[model samples]
Target chain A: MTSAVELDHVTVRFGAFTAVQDATLSIEAGEFFSFLGPSGCGKTTLLRTISGFIEPSEGQVRIGGTDMRGLGPNRRPTALIFQNLALFPMMSVAENIAYGLRVRGVSRSARREVAERLLDLIALPGHADKRVDELSGGQKQRVAIARALAVEPKVLLLDEPLSALDLKLRQHMRNELRAIQRRVGITFIYITHDQGEALAMSDRIAVMNRGVIEQVADGRTLYEAPRTAFVASFVGENNAFVGTVAEADRDRALVTTAAGPLSGRNLRNLMRTSEAVLFVRPEAVVLGEGPLTGRATEVAYEGILTHATFELDGGGRMTATIPRGAPVPKPGAAVRLGYDPADALVLPREGFAHA
Target chain B: MHSSVGHWLILALPVAVVLFYAAMALLDRRRAPGARPVSFVQRNGIAVSTYLVVAVGVWTVLLIVLPQLYMIDLSFRPRLPPTQMGGPNDVYTLENYRFFLYGSTRSTAAWNTIHLKAFALTILASVAITFLNLLLCYPIAFYMAKAASTTRMRLLMLMLIAPYWVNEILRAFAIRVLLASSGVVNQALMGLGLVSEPVDFLGLDLGLYAGLSYAYLLMMVFPLYNAIESLDRNQIEAARDLGGPWWHIHLFVVVPHAKPGIASGCTLVFMLTAGALAAPQILGGPRTLWFTPIVYDRFYQAFNWPQGAAYAFLLLVACIVFVLATMRVCRLSLGEITR
Candidate 1:
C-alpha cells in the first residue's frame, strides 16, 4: 500500500517481435491490478517488464518515483511468482521461503523464524519442513505465495499461478489469493489469460492484445463500458450489428441495422459516416412483441441464464439473455424482441483498435 | 532422392493413412463422451488390440523376431560347404569361438592379442570418459538451457555443435598429428624451451589413448548436450531460488533432472566403444587387443568358421547383456529416463 509502480510508455521487443508496445499504465499503491488477455496477447510480457525480467524497448519503469532502469530482477523491489510457481523440488518449505532473506545475508535462525511467521500468514503453519515435491498442489501454491512475500517486496508479481489447477480448486484459490494479497497490503501485478480470474480478483484490469494495452479500467467500468469491440467481446459476451446510422445527434443516434432500425443514447462515433458497427449487450436486449420479429433458433442453458439466438426475417442473428426460470420460447417459435434504446453502446469498428 | 517415387509414396501414404485414422479416433473420442456411446466391448477391444499389436510389432522389428531369425541364422550357417570337416550340416559347435578365443600356434590368445586388448580398452575407456565428460558437458549444457536462452545464446550453441560437420576420423587424425613428435605440440614445447629434446608421444600408447579419448569426446558431448539442453532450467533456478547455492543446486536440481540423459549418454558411449575396433587400433597401436578384432581374425585370418561365428555370437551376447543391464540401470521400463 506504500508504493506505486509506473510503466512509462514501456515497450518490450525480442529481436524483431514486439511483445509489448508503448504501454503506459499507473498502478496505485496496494492496488490489485491485473493484465488480462488471451494467450500471446503480451499481457505476460507487460507483467515481466514490470518485474524487470524484460527491459522496455522504449521507455522506463518506475517504482515509488524511482527509475527502475539498469535494475535486474533480483535487484528490483519486486518478487515474482512465476506461472509454473517454480518451487524448488529439493528444498523444504521453510528454506524455500527463506531464499530471499538468505540472498540478503540473513542468519539461518532469523530466516527460519521469519519463514515460520510467513507460513502461518499463508495458513499453513506446520509445512515448513516438507519438500515442495511432497506438498499437494494447493499447499505448493501457498508456499509459493509465502516465498514471494518473504523478501518483503513493495510489489508482488504473479503470472497465471492458478492456470494449472482444476476449475474448482482454481475458484477456491482465487478467494485465497485475494485474501492473501489483502493481508499483505503489497501492490500486486497479476497477469492472466483468464477473464473470469482477472475480473473476479483485480481492483483494475488492463486488457491487452498484440503487444498493446487496449483499456485500463476497474472491473465494473470495463464490463459496463468497454471502449473497443475486442475488450467487449473478450471481457464478456455481446451481440454486435453492422449498420448505417439512420440518425446522429447529441447524446442519441438511430442506426439502420441488419435486423432493422435501432436507436441508442450517449454512444460516440469517430467514424465520418453512418456506416459504423454498433454493439449491444445480450442482457440489455428485452424479449416481447416489438418492431423486430425473429424465430428463436437456439437456446443454451448456462445454469443461471439461458442465452437464445434469434434469426430475424431480414437474415440477421440477434441474441437475448433471459433468466433461466423464465418462460422460454422453444426453437423455431416466432417471437418479438426489444431492448432499452439507451443501453445500446455504439462503438466504432477499427481492426487495430485496442479493445 | 535415391528412392524418389518410393520416398514420396512412403511419406504421403503414411501421412494420409495417419490423418484418416486420426479423424476416426477424434470422432470416436467425441462420440464416447456423449450419451449412448460406442459399445464398451468394441471400444475397449480396439484400444487393447491396437496397443498390443503395435507393441508386438515394435518388439519383433527391434528385438524378438529379427535378430534370432536373421543375424543368428547367418552366424549358424557356414560361409562354405563343411562336409569334409564333419557331417553334412557341419553341426554348430564352440569351434568358431575357440579359434577366436585361442588362435593358431603363431597367434596369441584373445586376451594377449593387441586388437582384442584395444577393443576391451575402448569399452572400458568409453565408460570412464562418460563420467569425466559429464563434468565438462554439464556446465555448458546448463548455460545453454538457462542463461543463454536468448538468440545469441542459441547461436553460440549452434557454433558449439558445428564441429560435427567435420568427419570424426579427420578430427581423430588431427589429434594424432598434434601429438606427433615433430608436430605442433612438441614443436611449441621445444620453442618454449620446456624440453631440450622432442618428447616421444606418438610412438607410445599413452599419446594414442589420449588421441582416442579426445576424438570420442564429441560423441559424449552431443548426447550429454541433448540431456542438459532439454532440462527444464526453471527447475534448477527454482532450486537456486529456494536457497541452493552454486554446488548444491546441481546435486539437488541439475543432476537429478539430467539423470535420464546421463544414463542414455553413458549407455551410448559404452555400447559404441564395446564393439569398437577402429579408434583404438589407429590410436592405441598394436599393443591393445579389442574383442571385435579377435572375432574378425577367427573369421578371416584363421580357417575356423565355427569358432568365428561363436566369437561373433559371444560379442553379440555381451552387447545384449550390456543393453539389458543398461535398461535396468537407466530404469528404461519406468519410461522416464530413456524417453
Candidate 2:
C-alpha cells in the first residue's frame, strides 16, 4: 500500500540561484515523514522534486525501486495536496472529489459511489451537492484530501496545507490527518515550517536550512541528541555558552568560559584547546545547587511554568524553567545553577547565522 | 379612467423593462451556477442613494431610450420629396420597410443584390471572423498570461498595442495597400516562384477579412488575457497531479475558468465586425456590398432616409438577437459580461 521514496544527490538550480543543493535521503514505506524548516530553506523544493513537479538539475529519484527519470507529475504515482488546497471552484463537492476518478475513465455511477464514500470518510456524508464556496475552511481541507485519495497513489505529499487554518482547527486537523494516514497505511510526506506539527505527527523529521539538510532522525532522537549547532538551536530552546575546551575524555569535556569551567558530555568528540559551545536545556538547569552562581535578573510567569533568567557574575546569562507551583527566588537575589553531565552537550563550534 | 390611461401611456415600456429585470433576478437567485446571487441593492450597497438611482434613470432614458424611439419613429415615415420635406403629407406608413423587402425584385441584375441576402452574409461573415480571432488569439493570450516571463509579456503587450496607436482608418488603408495586386505580398509570392503572375487579392475578399480581423485584434486579446491571468496556477497543477492529460486539463479547468472572458471578447468582436462600414468600403471590391454600405447608400446616395432608418433598425435588432443567443449558449449573465 506504500512505497519508499529515495533521492540520490539531487540538485536543483534556477539560473544564478541554487534552490536545493545536492540532497540525498530515503523515506521508508508507510512512515509519516516531515521536512521541517524556516521559510526559504528549500523544504518545499525537495518535496516538489519527490512529487515530480521538478526535475533535478542533476541526479536521480527513485520510488519503490523504480527510477523515475523523465517522468512528469502526471506520469508518477504520487499526489500532492497544495498549500492553498486548489480545489476546483467551478465544481460541486462530489465532482471535485470524483475528478481523478473521471480522468481515469471510471464509470459515472462508480465515481459517484466513490465520491460519496470518500465524503463519508471525511465526515461530510451529505455534502455532495454543495459547491466549494459554500463549505467552511476545514471542510474544504478535507475535500482536498478526499480528492487526492480518490486516485489512491502510493505516496501522499502535502505542502503546508494546514497553514491557512485557525490555530484550534489546525490542531484538530492534525489528529484527524494522522488518523486517516494510519488507516490508509500509505507513505505520508508532509512539509511544514511548524515544529509543533512535525513533532506531534511525524515518525521522523528532516530539519533543513539554507538549501541543505542539517539532520534527519526520529522525533525523540532529534529532540534529545541533535548533532549540529543548527539542529540544536532549531529543534528547541537551549542556553548556549561559547568557550574553549579545557579537558577532554572519551564521553566528557570541560569547557572554560568567562564565567567558570563547565563540564558536559562530549557528543562531538571535543579535543583539548578546541573552540566549543556547551548547550544546556532550561528544564535541565537546577537552582540552588552545584558549580555556578548568578543574580536573578528577570522572572517570567507562564501559565504552567516559570522561567527565571540569571546573569552570571562574570558574564553570560542562563534561564531556568521551574514548575509554576514551585516557589521562585526574588529578583536580584543570588541564585546557583547546575545540571547533570549527561543533560549538557559539548560540541565543536559551528557558526550558525541567526535570522 | 382617463388619468389611469395617461399613466399607462407614459409608463408601459419602463414598467416592462423593470419587470424583465425582476424576472431575471429571480431566475438568477434560484440557479446561478458557481456564483453568488447579489441583489441590485447589494451590488450598489449603501452608497446608492435615491439621488444616484434617479440620476441613472434619467441618463438611461435621455441618452439610450429616446434616441432609439426617435429612430423607430423615423423608420415608419414616408420619404417625401425635397420640396415637401417635413411637410404634413409625410405620412407614417410601412412603405419604407416594404421597399427593403421587394425593391430588388425590380432589378434582376446580380450587382444590385437583395437587402436580405446582404444582411445574412454580413452576419455570417462576422461570426466567422469572431471564431477565427478566438482561435488565433487564445493561445497568444494564454502564453502572455501564464507562460511568458513578465519582461517578455510586457514586450508582447507593447507590440500588440503599438499598431493601434495609429488611427484605425490609417491601419486599414495600410493593409489595403499591402494586399493590393502589386504590393509586397504578391511580389514576394512571385519572387518565391509560387506564382508566375500577380493574383487579385481583393477579388477573393481576403483584404476585407484581413482588415477587419486586424482592426479588432486588441479587443479579443485583452479580455482573454485578463481572464486567463486571474486563473490560479495551482488548479492546473492539481489536475495534472491527478493524471489528467494536457488537453483534458484545459477542457476541465482552464476553459471553464475563462468562459466569461471568452464571452465578452466574442461579443465585442462580433458586434464590431457586423456593423463595420469603413473597412469593407475601403477594402472590398465591387462585389463586396455589405449591409452597412447598403444602408449608407440609401441615406446618402439614394436620398431615401426612411428606408435607410428601416435597414439600420433591422441591423440593430439582428445585433441584439446575436448578443442574446451568444449569452444563452455560453450561459453567461449580462452582469458577468459587463464586468
Candidate 3:
C-alpha cells in the first residue's frame, strides 16, 4: 500500500523558532513508527504537524498519498492521542470511544455496535458506562486508543500517550499499544521521550535531536549500529573515544585514538578522515586482563548485571555491563577494556553534536 | 424630636457592649486554652473575640431583625405629628398599608398601579438578558482561559474591565445619545441609505431596554466566562480524541463542567436586573418602568414609609423565591453554583 504517512522536508516554524526542521520520513502501513527524543526535542511538534494540528512552514505532509497542508484536524483521516490522554472526563467510557464515529455522523445503534467492538478490542469490554476519571491510568490509555481507532483513521498519531503512567503500567501498555497497532493494521506514529518505551514498541524509530531526525532504523540497527555519536550515546550507554579515521575501504576503517589505534566498522555515511567520535556499545565492550586499562570511576549492581564506568587516563569514558555474578569492579580499581572491531562505529566529527 | 435616655443608651451601648464581650472572651479562653501560642492567642484573640461578640450582639439588635420590626412598629404609629405620639394620645392603625398597598388618592393609586406593574416587565426582561449573557459569555471565557500567557489574556481581559470603569449611568447616557431621535444612530442609518426617515429611539421602551441591557450585559459575561475559563481544555480534547464532534464535546464535556458558572451568572443577573434602577431610570424614557423605581416612589414621593417598606419587603421575598426556584431547578446547592 501507499506508505502510511510521508513527511517531505516538513519544516514547522513558530515565528523565528523552528519547532521541527527539514524532516522527512515514510512509515509503511501496519508499521509502528516512533519519534524518540528528549524534552523540547520537537517529537511532539512533528506528531502535531502530522495530525494537522499544525501546518508545515516549508513542506507538505502526505498521509496515504494525499497532501495534508490545509486540512483541519477533524477534516483529516487522522486522529491524535494527546500527551495528557485527553479523555472527556464528563463522558462515559463508551461515549468517549464513540466520539469519533458520532462526529462522523454514524447512526446511534451502529455507533454503539462499533464502540462495543472497540471496547472489546481494547480489552475493556464491560466498561462502557464508566466515567473516564473512574478508570485507572492504563485503562484511560486504552480508552484513548480505542477512541482514536473509532474513527478508523488510516494513521493514528500518539503524542506520548503512555508517558503519564507509572513504570509497570507504561511497560504493559507498550505491548498493548503494539498489539493494537498490529490488530488494526494502521500506521501508528508514536512520539515519546522515553527510550525504553520506544525501543520496546516501535517497529522502527526515528531518533530526533534539536528538531531533526538523527537516524531512523529498526531496534537492532538503532542499538547496534547507531550512525552518530549522539544516537550511540543516547540510545544506550556507550564507550566513546576522540579519533581520526586512519583509512577506510568500503566497510572496515582503522581509527587512531589517544589511547591507541583501534579497528572499527565503517560508518561510511558519516565518516571522514578527520578527528571524530567513536562509539562502542557498553555491552559490546569485553573486560578482561588484556589490552588497555582504566580506573573504575563507579559501579552499579542491577540484579542482572554489574555495570562499571571506566575513566580513561589519556581521555574519554566507557561503560561495561558484565553479568551479575561476574567479579564486581570496586571504585578506584583498575580494569582492562576491549571491544570487537564490529562494535566501534566512528562518525564524522561534525554529525555528532547539535551545533 | 429626640428621646433623651434612648439616644444616650445608643451612644453608651458601644462601650458597654465592648466590656461585656471582653468579659465573655476571657471566660471562653479560661475554659478552653487553644493550641496556639498563649501569648499570641491572648494578644489577637482577646481583641478579635471581644470585637466579634460585641459587634454581632449589637448588630442583632440593630441591623439584622431590628429594622423590619422598627418599620412594622412605625407603620402601626401614625405619620409624624406632635399630637400623635407619647405627648398627646398615642394610637396605632393599619390604614397606612391599606392606603398605600391600594392607593387612596387617584394620583397615588395611579403611581402604585405603575409600581406593581413594573415587576412582571422587569422579571421578563431580566430573564431574557441573563439567558443571552450566558450564551455570549461562554465562548469569550473559553478563549481567554486558553491563552498561552497570563499577560496576553489579561490584555484582552482589560477590554471588558475598561468598560466597567465607565459609570453605568454614563454608559447608558452615551447609548441614549446615540439612539436619540434624529441623533447619531438615525444619522448613521440615513447615511447608509437604509432608511428614508430617522428612526426614533427616544421616549420608547425599546430604546430604554437596549441601553439597560448594554449596561448590564458585562455582569453576565464575567461569571459565565469564568465558568467556561475554569474548564480544563484537556477534557474537551479527550472527548475529541474519543471521536466526539462539536455537539458531543459541548453537550457531554463543556456544558456540564461549566454548569456552576452558568447558574451563578444567571442568578446574579436575575437578582440585580429584577431590582434594577440605574439602567432603567437612565435609559428607559417613560414607557419602560422598573420595580426599584416603584419602591423609590413609595418611599419618597408618597410620604408613605410603611407602604414603601412593605413593597421593599415584598421585593426581598420575591428575590428569595426566585433564587430558591433557580437552585431547585438546577438540582444544586447555592455553594456549588457560586464556586
Candidate 4:
C-alpha cells in the first residue's frame, strides 16, 4: 500500500497570493519526509496539495508515478491525519479505526479483525471498546494514526499531528510515529513548524519560507550545510554577521564585517552579490580565547547548556552556549567569541533581507 | 374533603406516574452492571443544594403537574348547558371521551367515524410534515454550519429569518393565494403549456403541507445547525481522506454526530404540527378536518368545554408518545436531546 510521490512544478494560488510556488520534489517509497517552516510559510499548504484536498493551480502531483490531476481527496490513494486528530467522538475506538473498512463495504467481522490488528500495532491493544474521548492524549493520537492506516493508503500525510500534545508526550509520540511509519513502509509526508520534531523524525526535510522551498536535504546536511540564508536562520539558532564579500574561492569566501574580516565556506556562492551573512551556530562559536570580542548582556540557564547573549562591540548580538557545569561569563563581563571557518557558512543576504 | 372521585384520580394519577418513573430509572440503572448506584436526588444533581431541590420541585408542580391535573379534571366533567350552569348536575362523567370512540347516546351509531378519521389523519399529516422538514432542512443546515464561509453563512441565516418576519398568518394566506386556481404557480404552469388548465392545489392538501413545513423550518434548522456546527471539520476531512464517499461520510460520521439535533427538531416539529390549527384551517382542502379543528369546534362553536378538554388531552398524550418514540428510535435520551 506504499508508493513514491512526486511533485512536478507544483504551484498553488489563492486569488493573488501564491501559497506554494513551483515546488518540485520526489519522495522515495517508505521515506519519512517533512516540510519544516515557520507559521504561514506554506508547509501546510504543500502537504494539503499533496493530499488532494487542494488542487494545484499549476502543476502535477504524481503518486506511485501516476498523475493525480483533478482527483478529489476521497479518490486519491492517500490518507491524512489532521492536526486535531479528529477522532469521531461518538464512536468507540474500534468503530473509529474500522471506519475506512466500513466505508469500503467490508464485512462487519472483517472490519473488527482489521481494527484489532491495527490496535495491536499501535500498542493500544484492547482499546477498541473504549470511546475516543476516554483515551489519553497519546492514545488518541495512536488511534488517529491507526484510523488513517486502516485504509491502507499508499501515502500517509500528517498535518502537525503532535502539536496538541504536551512536550513530554510529543517527544515520546515522535519516536512512536517514526517506528510506525517504518513498520508500515508507506511514504509519509509530515508537515511541522517544530524543527525538533522535523529533525528528530524525518529522513529528509524541506525547509520552506514565503511559498518557496529554501532547501531539501537530510537533517545533518540542513544543519551543517544550509544552502540559503533563510534555511540557516530558520532551522536552528545562529549568529548572523552581515558583511560584504572581500575575497571568493571555489568553496570558500572571505567576508568583511563590522567585526573585521571573517572567512567561511561559500555555501551559496555569495561572490556575485558581494553582500552576504556569515552564520555560525552558538555551539560552534568558541568563547574565552578568540580575536572577536563582545560584552555579555544576558545569561540563561537552560538545563544542560547555559546560554550567554553578548552585545558585540562592532554590532548585533551573538550568543554562546557553554555546558552548564563549565565556567560561564557573567552579565556585563567582556567576552571573546570565535569559530573555525569550516563551522561558519557564508550565504547571500539578498533573500534573507525581507525575512 | 368534599371533592369528587375525579379530583382524587387527578391527584393520584401524577403520583402514580412519578412512582413509575422512579421504578424505571432504578431498573435502567440496574441494567448497566458496575455502574455506581445513585439515589434520585444524587442522580439528578438535586443534592448539590437545597435551593436547587426546592426550585426543581416548585417548577415541576407549578408548571407541569398542576396544569395537567387541572386539565384531567376538566376532561372528566360533563359540559353544563346554559340553564344548568353552576348547578349540582355539573358532575363528572366519561361521556365526553365516549363521544370520540362511539356516537352520542341519542344516535346509537357504533362508532364516530368523522372524529376518528380526523385524529388518524392529523397524526399521519404531522408525521409527514416532520419527515419533510428534516429532508428539507438537513442540507441547508449542513451547508450553513460546515461548508459556507462566515459571510455567506450570515447571509443564509438572514434569508432563513426573512420569511418569518412577515408573520405566520400572513405567510399562510400568501401560500393560500398562491394555491388558488388562477394563482401565480398555476398561471405560470398553464402559460408554459405544462398543464392545459389550472390545477386545484388545495384539493391535494399541498398548501397545508407547504405552510406547516415552512412554519417550523427554523425549529428544524437551528437545532440541526447547532449540533453540526460543533462537529469538527477535521472529522469530515479524515473520513473523506480514508476513501469514504459522500454518503458514507454522512452515514457514519455526520448523521451520528447530529442525532441529538435531529431528535429534538423532529420531536418539536411533530408536536407543534400535531396541535396546529391555523395552517390546516387556512390552507386545508374543504374535506380536510384535522383533530385540532374538531377540538376547536367543540370548545367554541358547540360550546362543549368538557369534550374539547378530552380531545385536547388525547392529542397531548399522542404528542408525548411520539416524542418518546422518536427519542427511542434515535437512541438519544431526553437530556441529550434537550441539550
Candidate 5:
C-alpha cells in the first residue's frame, strides 16, 4: 500500500528564513506519527505545509501517492486540529463535528447521524448539543479530534492539541488519543514539544531540531539507539563525557576523558585520537567503584528512584538514578560511577548542532 | 398641571433610583472581614463618591433628561400666540399630534398621505442606507481587522477618517459637486459612453443615500472591526479546513461572531441617517422630503414648536423601536451591543 503521506524534500521559506528545510519523510497508513521539537523548531510549519495551509517553497507533498500541488487546505484530504483546538464557539458540538459534512452538501439528518457516531467514538455520546465553551479543556480536545475525524480524511494533523490541559488530564488524554487513533485506523500526525507525550503516543517519532529532522524511529529505538547526539540528549536524560578516542575497535572504543579512560560502544566508527563524546544513560551508570569519580552534590528522592547529581572531579557534572531499595549516595560524599561498555554510546563530537 | 404630575414622576424615577443606590452604598459601611469587597463609594471615600454622583446626576438631568422632558411636555400642548400663553387656549392637548392626520378626514387613508409617506419613506431610506453601509463596510472592516498589516490598517483608517474632518455640510456639498447634473461623476460616465446624458443622482435620491452612507461609514466599520478583530482567527481556518467555501466560512463563523457589532453599527447608522438634516437638505433633490426636514420646517420656518416637538418625539420613538427590533433580530442585548 502507498504511504498515507509523503513529503519529498519539502522546504518552506518565509522570505529569507527557512522554517522547514529539506524535510522528507514517509508516513504509512494507519500509523501514529509525530514530529517532536522545541517551539519555533518548524514542526508546526511542516504540519501546515502537509495540511496545505502553506505550500512549500520547494518540493512536493503527496497524500496517498497523489501530489497535492496548488491545493488549498479545504481541497486536501487532511484536517488540522489547531493548538488551541479552535472549536467554533458559536456552533454546538454536533454542528462543529458535522461542519465538514455540511460543506460537502450532506443532508442534515445524515450529518447528525455521523456526528452522533463520532461523538460516541470520542466517548462524548450525549454532548452533541453542548456549546464549544461549555466543554472542559479535555472535552474540547476530544471535540477537536472528533471534528477533524468527521471529515474522514486519510490523515489527521494535530498541532499539540493537549498542550493546554492540566498534567493529569493531558496524560489521560494521551492514551485516549492513542486508543482513538487505533480504533479509527487512519493515519494520525501529531506535533508536540513534549518528548514524553511524543514517546508515549507515537508509533514512529521524528525528532526535529533547528528545522532538521534528526532521526525517525520507534519509541524504544529512539530512546535507546539515537543516531545523533542531539537526539540522544533530547529524547531522554544522559551524562555526556566529551573526550578524544584513545583506542578504537570494530564495535568498542576507549575515550580518554579528564577523569580517566572510558570505554564505550562506537556506533560511529572513529580511529585513534579522533574527538568523540561518550553518552551514558542515568540508569546505566552504576554507583559503586569504577573508573570515573566525582563528589556527590545533590540527591533528590523521587517515589521510585533517587536521582543523584555528582560534580565530577574532571570538571563536569553527571546524574545517576538509583532504583527503589538501592542505596543512594549522600551529598558531599565522594562517589565512583561506571557504566557497561554496551550501555554507553561514543558518537562523533560533531553531530547535529542546533542552530 | 395636575395631569403633568404623572409625567414628572416618570421623569423622576431614574433619579430616585440613582439616589437610592447611592444612599444604600453609603449606609453599608460596616463589613465583616472579606465578606465582600468594599463598595465603590467606600473605596473612593464618601466625599469623592458623592461628588461624582452629583456631577453625573447634574449632567444627565440638565443635558439629557430635562430637554427630553420639556420636549415631551411641549408635544402634548397646543401652539398659541404670546398674548394667550397661559390662557385656556394654551392648555395641554393632542392637537399637535392630530395635525399629522389632518388630511385623513378628506381621504380614505387613516393618516395624511403626504406627511405619512414622507415619514415612512424616510425610515425606509434610512434602513436601506444602513444596509448599504453594512455591505460596504463589512469587507473593509474584515480586511482591516484580519487581512491588513498594522501599517496598512493605519493607512486605511486615516483615509476613511480624514474626509470626516471636514464639516458634514461641506462633505455633503462635496458629494453634491460630484453628483450634480454636470458634475464629475456624470462627466466621467458620459465620457466613457456609459450614458449619453447625465444621470439625475440628486433627483433620484441616490446622492442623498451616498452622502448619508458616507457620513456614517466609520460608525459601521469601527464596530465591525472591533468585533471581528477579537474573533479567534483559528475558527475561520477551521471552517476553511472543513471544506467550507468563502461564503460559508463567513456565514457560519465570522458573521455570527460579529452579530453584536453588526447590531451596534446598524443601530448607529439607522438612527443617524433617520435624524440627519444637513446631508438631506444639501444633497436631497426637490422631490425628496425627509422627515427631519419636516420637523425643521415646523420649528423654524413654520414657527410651530409644539408640532415640531411631536414630530421629533415620533422620530425618537421610531429610532428606539428600530434599536429594539435590531437587538431582537440579532439575538443580542443592549449590553452586548454596547460592549
Candidate 6:
C-alpha cells in the first residue's frame, strides 16, 4: 500500500535559523504516528509542512503518492487541528462541523446528516444546536476533532490538541483520540511535547531533538532500546552513569565508572576506551543487593510504589522505584542498586544526555 | 425657586445613576479577594476624587446636555425679534417645522422640492460613501492586522494618519485641486491619452464622494483593524485546512468576527458624511447642493435660527434612526458597537 504521507529530506529554514532539517519519513496508511519532542524541536514545523501551510524550504511532500508542490492548504487532502482547537465561536456545533462540506457546495440536508453522524461518532449526539462556548473543554476538543474529520482527509494532523486540557482530562482524551483514529481508519500525525501523551497514543513514535529525528520506534522499543542518549533520557525516567568503555563485545560491554565497573548490553557497539553512558530505568534498579551502593537521600511513597533517590558514593544521584510490599528505605540508609545487563544499555554519549 | 427645583429634578435621574454605579464599583473593589483594607477615599484621596467627579459632571451637564436641550427647545419656537420675545405671540409652535415642508409655497403638496431633493441626495450619497469606504478599507485593514509585520503595520498606520494632521478644510481644498477640471488627474489622463478631454470629476460629484470617503477612511480602518486583529489566526488556518477557499474563509470566519467593527464604522462614516459641510462646500460643483449647506444658509446667511435648529434636529433624528437600523440589521447591541 502506498504511504499516506511522505516527506523527502524536508528542510525548513527561516533566514539563518533552521526550524526543521532533513526530516525524511513516511507515515503508513491508517497508522497513528507521533512526533515527540520538547518545545522548539521543529516538530510543529514539520506538521505544518505536511498540512501545506509552510512549504519546505528544500524537499518534497507527497500525499497518497501525489506530489503536493504548489498546492495550497485548501487543496490538500489533509486537515490540521490547531493547538488551541480554533473552533468557530460564532457557529453552532453542527454548523462548525458542516463548515467544510458547506464550502464544498454540499446541500444543507446532506451536510447536516454528515454533521450528525460525526457528532455521534465524537459522542456528542444531540449537541448539534449548542453554541461553541457552551461546551466544556473536552467537549470542545471532541467537536474540533469532529470538525476536522468532517472533511474526510486521508491524513489528519493534530498539533498538541490536548495540551490545553487538565491532566486527568488530557489522559482521558488521549485514549479517546486513539479510539477515534482507529474508527476513522485514517493516518494520524500527532505533534506534542508530552512524552507520555505520544507514547500512550501513538503506534510508532519519532523522537526529535533540535531539528533532527533521533529515533523512530514502537513505545516498548523506544523505552527498552533507545538508539540515542536523548531518547533514553527523554522517553522515561532513567539513572545515567557516564564513563569510558573498559571492554567491548558484540552484545554487551563493560564501562568503568567512578564507583566501579558496570556491565550492560552494548546497543551502540563502542570501541574500548571510548566515552559512553549506561542508562538504567528507575523501575529496573534493584535496591536490596547489588555491586554498587549509595546513601538514600530521599524516599517518597506514592501508594502503589515508593521512589527512593540516592546520593551515589561515586558522586552522582540515582533514583529507584520500589514496588509495594517491599521494605521502603529511609533517608540516610545505605542501599545497593543494581540492574540486569539486558534491562540497561551502554550507548555512545553522542546527543542530548538529559531531557 | 420653583423653576430651579424643577431643573434639579430633571438632573436627578442621571446623577443618581452615576452615583449608584460609582458606589457599586467602590463596593466591588473593597469586597474583592486579596484587597487591601484601604477605603475608596483613602485610595483616591477626597480632594482628587471630588475634583474628578465635579469636572466630569460639569462637562457633561454644561457642555453637552445644555446645548442639545436648548437646540431642541429652539426647534419648536418661532424666530421672533428680541423686542417681541416673550410677548403675546411668544409661544411654542410647529411653524418652523411646517416651513420645512412648504419652504415659501402656499400649497402643501407643492412642497420645497429643491430642499427635499437635496435632503434625499445627501442621505443616499452618504450611504454610498459609507459602503465605498468599507469596501476600500477592509483589505487594507486585514493586511495591516494579519499579514504585515510589526514595523510594517506601524509604518502603514503612520502613512494613513499623517495627512489628517493638516486642517480638514485644507485637505478638502487639496482634494478639490486634485480633482478639478484642469487638475493633475485630468492632466495625467490627457498625457496618457486615456481621454480626449478633461473628465470633469467635480462636475460629476466624484470629488465630493472621494473627499467624504477620504475624510473618514481612518474611522473605518481602525475599527476594522481592532476587530480583525483580535481574531485568532489559527481559526483562519483551521478554515483553510478544512478546504475553505479565500472568499469562503472570509465569509464564514473573518467577516462574522468583524461584524461589530463594520457596523460601527459604517454608522460613523454615514453620520459624518451626512453632516459634512466643509467638504461639500469646497468640492461642490456649480449645480451641487447638499442638505447641510441649506441648513448652514438657514443659520448664518438667512439668520433663521429656528428653522436651522429644526433642520439640524431632523438630521440628528435621521442619523439616530440609521444607527438603530444598523444595530437591528447587524444584530449587535449598543455596547458591542461602541466597544
Candidate 5 — which residues are off by over 4 angstroms? A271-274, A351-355, B1-14, B17-37, B103-110
Report the C-alpha lDDT of model 1 over A18-88, residue by residue, as the tens digit. Answer: 98889887899999999999899898878777777677889999998899997767677887887788876
The deviation in Å at residue A108 for candidate 4 is 1.3
| Model 2, span A1-355: residue lDDT tens | 3248988998999897888888888889999999999999999998889888899999889998799989999988899999999999999999999999899999999999999999988899999999999999999999999999999988999999999999999999999999989988989999999999999999999999888888899878878998877777778888888889999998999999877899999988989999888889999998899788999999999989999999998688989899977879799999888999899998778656631
* DockQ metric, candidate 3: 0.41
Q: For model 3, how does the per-residue alpha-carbon lDDT over A52-141 read when each residue is reduced to its tens digit?
A: 767889998988899987776777778888888777666788878887777777898998898899999999999999888899989888
**Ten-residue stretch with the least lDDT total in model 2 chain B:** B1-10
- Residue-level lDDT tens digits of model 6 in A10-94: 9999899999999988889999999999999999999999999999999999999999999989999999999999999999999
Model 3: per-residue lDDT, tens digit, B1-339?
A: 333443454556655876898899778778886643455447668788788767887787668655655555555545556554554334455666555446652234444465556767777777787776666676777667654378877887788789879887788788888888777989999999999987767676767667656666667677767777777776776555445667767776778888887788778877877777777777776676777887788779977676677666667777878778978987778888768
Model 1 bad stretches (over 4 Å): A1-3, A90-92, A99-111, A129-134, A267-275, A301-303, A324-326, A352-355, B1-131, B140-174, B188-209, B236-252, B263-339
Interface RMSD of 6: 0.6
Provide the interface RMSD of candidate 2 in angstroms, 1 decimal place. Answer: 0.5
What lDDT tens digits, residue by residue, belong to model 4 across residues A1-355? 4249998999999999999999998898989999999899898898889999999999999999899998999889898999998999989999999998888889999999999999999999989999888999999999999999999998999999999999999999999999999899998999999999999999999999999998999999999889888998988899898888999987899988888888899966666448899898999889887768999999999999999999988877889889867898989998888898888999988678542
User: Could you tally the backbone clashes for each prediction?
Assistant: 18, 0, 5, 0, 0, 0
The CAPRI classification for model 5 reads as high
- Winning candidate number (TM-score): 5
Error of 5 at B225 (Å): 0.4
Judged by lDDT against the true structure, how good is candidate 4?
A: 0.89
The weakest ten consecutive residues by lDDT in model 4 chain A span A267-276
Clashing pairs in 3: A86-B238, A87-B238, A99-B243, A99-B244, A100-B243
Off by over 4 Å in 4: A1-3, A353-355, B1-68, B82-87, B105-109
Q: Best to worst by DockQ, what's the order?
A: 6, 5, 2, 4, 3, 1
Report lDDT (Cα) of residue A186, candidate 5.
Answer: 95
lDDT of each: 0.73, 0.88, 0.77, 0.89, 0.90, 0.90
Better of 3 and 5 by TM-score: 5
lDDT of predicted model 6: 0.90
DockQ of 5: 0.85
Q: Which consecutive 10 residues in model 3 chain B have the weakest lDDT in total? A: B1-10
Question: Against the hidden reference, what TM-scores do the models get?
Answer: 0.68, 0.89, 0.85, 0.90, 0.95, 0.94
Off by over 4 Å in 6: A353-355, B1-49, B105-109
